[model samples]
Target: NESVWTADQNEEMSNTSASPDSVSLADVSAEKATQGSDTDLEVEDPEKAFAGVMGAELYLEACRLTEVVPVSHFIQNLSKPYVNLNHHGLGPKGVKAIAIALVSNGTITHLELEDNCILAEGAIYIAEMLRENSSLQELNISNNHLDTAGAEAIASLLLDNMSYLHALQLSGGLYALKQSHCVCTFVSLQGNYQVKELDLSHNGFSEKGGQLLGQMLARNTTLEILDLSWNHLSRKGTVALGTGLRGNGALKILNLSWNGIGNEGALALGEALKVNNVLVHLDISNNQINNEGAKNLCRGLEVNGKLKILKMANNPLTVEGATALLASVRKNHNCMMEEINISNVLVNETFIKLLDLVCRMRPELDVIHGEVEGCITKIPKQHPNPMKVIQKYLKEHNLQLWDFFRNIDKDGNMKIPVAAFRRAMMQQQNIPLDRVQIGELVRQLDRHRTGIVDY
Candidate 1:
């Protein structure tokens, strides 16, 4: 995020996994149970029958799809705590059979039923099992044909008196992710006080649905992470959510990216941050937030303390809003953010200035962004205001670009030696950057791949 790199800072960051629990099984053995790894017991196929799916075509389908003969062969042991039947060609018949077994079994805590081609009735059976189950903690029911009614039925599990469900991951396949039944699909989960993590990303729930989910957040106490990305939440919907988020405590991370939430929506969320103390991370990228909205968010930070990471990349913020946001963190002790991302928001010059200011003023808070466009696009060779760009960028870090350039300006012209720029950054600002870091900065300023940055 910044030029200062630690010895052990893994740079990769993204959340897209194939399995419900995409954790490493390395060093998984009885001797090292406390060494920090997800260890699920693996046993030989049990001979006992799963009477539920014994004679059904679902069993035949599972057997044919997977060469393991019987799909239930792996889940037959009543003591086994993990049941993963993902992509096993299980339809309604298969899901109902498994549901029948789960109704009586009380051992498994994690269940994966993704991409099984199950429909409404199958979802109903699973919902019934949720009504009675108590030991289960994670449920992955994505990629099934649970139409509107089926989805609502499962959603009502939140209202069930006995359902102790925690994490509900409905991040489904292409069809399921795009198909939404309407507001009812999620309104049933409103006021739910049990689940902690809910992933509704890639779904098509409308703004009305988003509003209802907001109402749920107001009443919920256990929910911590909520992912509603690409759900078409507009400003009105987000404003409604802000009403709930204003005082919410359990919620910490909110991902509303890839939606239609505009400047008003961002402002509303910023207002929420002013009063909400629990939320620490927020991702509102790809929205319509502009300069005013960015300023409003900065104002929120001026009074807020809990928010640690603000990811606002891909918005339409200009230099005015970007600098204000950075300055708020710099001026106010209340807004001690660990990371701020304004990537792809402003132009080449403006972005450089804002980035440099944050890097110098708050060395602990890393600013994340991408290369500037002008440098990348190779603006006019006889650029008129190149000096202004460089000076503004340097001023942000409390350094004079002219002075730094004068020492290396061999011809006494405005142009400076590109090789000396890296050394100047270290000498003037005490920011020691290696080749990788210096090369990255040069790319931002040398958009045209030019060897020298005249500005």
Candidate 2:
């Protein structure tokens, strides 16, 4: 015969067996029976038993349900604060599994999934996860095949008020999105206030894209660093962007390199600079800026004082343009210019003398230019060669040549790689040699055709 126990009966049994001294063998047996029944209930409905579990257990369950091959590194990184799964070839399904796992995860703060073939579907999954997850701060999804759909999903995620992401890298795939879709994404970004740094390089942004970006920049205030390098933001687009900059006050660093924004674009930026006071670093290198553009920039520099680093290298500016720019900096007593890079422009005695006077006024100012030209006939025959110029500059500035070499030699090896040497000579603030002189020096130093130069 079997009997059913009611709640009242169970309570009565538990109360009766509350005291160890008054407990009997029958009471102990009943308590054990109740425990076994509860265990059976848990086994019958395991999902209900573990419904609110989080972290690794939850991630593993997601992986199991999605049938994803759990990479060992990913599994290991589930407990870490930073996860790097770059170049893992994790396709849509794999990223979906990871997204499901990370939806409830609170540990990961930085996640890099670059070069993974996570297409549109995978991006959607990630976006959905981000809608729920708030711990993640930085996300790099560059080099993935995220097409228009994926970009739209990401843009929607940014529009969400719950998103806490600070840095977003969606570079290397913007060319796939149509102009309308790109405009949609940029419009979404305009409303976002959380993201501070954005990388949109390697994407061929046309005039439409530029206009969209300009409109976004006009309203968006939280963005600080923007990289628009290696794109096609030519005259019209650049002019629009410059118009946006005119009213913007939050942006500090902007990279517009390799965009063929010519004299017209430069004039637009010059107009923006006259009114804008917050921008600090501006890179307009490799643009088709000529003497007229340089003059336009000088006009801005004369009145504006906030700019610190200006990179105008590889433009078609002549010595006159360079001189005009330096002279503007000299004329502006309030200017805070620190480093000016015009490495592709030749300089003459007039420019050199003006640079010397400017340097004397602002000893910390570093000006970079190319080989001497234009007024070579006026220079005396006793003019020092490029090597002597470098030595003389270093000695006069109280900088050691070995220190420059050591800085480039990262491995502490006595020899510097040819590429590293050239880069250091051209970019290092202490080195006074220009590109043309550096090339000749490299050829003479590397006599054996070895790919390195001995100090």
Candidate 3:
């Protein structure tokens, strides 16, 4: 493969070096010749960076993608985790070249090809690459005109090689009912068994595709995060998703904001959450779910026990409705509440009491309320214990302890009681811990015998 690429680079060098401005790209070594500028990037081995870029350039040129990024930039950043080739007008031809390069390159894990206009033909090449590549984890192909054919092909790639792909971003128009149905069809028949995240935001979706997604969600246990925000999934579509959630035991984070899901849709989801023991993070922000919907949602949340994070920004939540929701969670002794976003909602005289409750229950809980800058004022922290410092560090990095908490608290409450700690950890994150060991750890955290720890 290197030999073939060298030959192509040699041909490209000879053909384009007619002017003094053109550098001998094939002969470039020791230093990358930027266009009258020196590269600011530092590398452990300059020689390795040179080789990486040369190989990428040769492979790209061989596939007739001449109008690509500068070789110097690619060399300096070849070993980085992500490659952003957005807005480069990488049409079908360029997309094919990139696909070929990606198959051989092992370092790049996240590839962004947004707005590249890589139509159906280009998508085929990408699918072929996905079949062969092993390092890629995320692919952003948004704003590419890869219609139904392209959609089916990418969907096939996800199903065939599920381990390599954890995230797929298909955000933009052209993701209507037809495209959604096409994607869901592949997922159901073939199976995207290992993908954890899927973002299809800003697509002009309707209920036909929503039903398809519901059908797929009913069985897929591997998917953990889903974003369908900024769409047109009104009550009809959201109801179907709710029905699917009723039986789903895997999904943890869901974003359905800006979808115009009115009170009816909110009611449906609230009812579903009553039986749902998995979902933890939910975003229904900017939906038309008014005071009635808020009350209904609280009714479900109070009885259900898994939710920890809820975002309701830009909803028309009146004083009565907002109070009802908060009161319901508090009265239920919900310690799992981590964050609540209620920006742009009407807050009445109960605002102070609401803030005080949140402050006492969760000193670390982030509350985004009202439109003022820094609406959530907090008191300065007291001196922390060494255990608290260690916990904070672990939480910051999402280390094993935090993962354990997340796994055990499947209902999204962010906090776990002392009694259920061991069982939940083993059942959720696959950590094998005995009752005694978990008891000791809980004792270390719960010094005052509060029976709770801020996870």
Against the reference, the lDDT scores of all candidates come to 0.64, 0.75, 0.68
The candidate, 1 or 2, that scores higher on lDDT is: 2
Ranking 1 against 3 by TM-score, winner: 3
* Model 1 agreement with the true structure over 1-455: per-residue lDDT tens digits: 11112101111111122322222222221212233322221112222223234323433433222212234443564457777777665555445546645655577788988876667766776887788767777888887877866776776666654577788887643234323533233543556677888887777666776777778778778789988888787888788888889868899999999888988888888889888999988999989888888887776888888887788998888767777887788777666576677877544676566656655554445566556666767763343343455556667778775666676566777654454554454345444453335546655666784446686
What's the TM-score of each model vs. the native? 0.64, 0.71, 0.68
- Residue 349 displacement (Å), model 3: 2.3
Which residue pairs collide, candidate 1?
375-447, 375-448, 376-447
What local lDDT score does residue 152 receive in model 2, on the 0 to 100 scale?
75
Q: Give the Cα-based TM-score of candidate 1 against the true structure.
A: 0.64
- Tens-digit per-residue lDDT, 85-153, candidate 2: 887766665576578678767889999998877777678778878888879999999878788878877
- Name the 10 consecutive residues with the lowest summed lDDT in model 1: 6-15
Q: Relative to the unseen true structure, what is the C-alpha lDDT of residue 440 in candidate 1, on a scale of 0 to 100?
A: 60
Model 1, position 151, has a per-residue lDDT of 73
Clashing pairs in 3: 306-411, 308-412, 336-413
The prediction achieving the highest TM-score against the true structure is 2
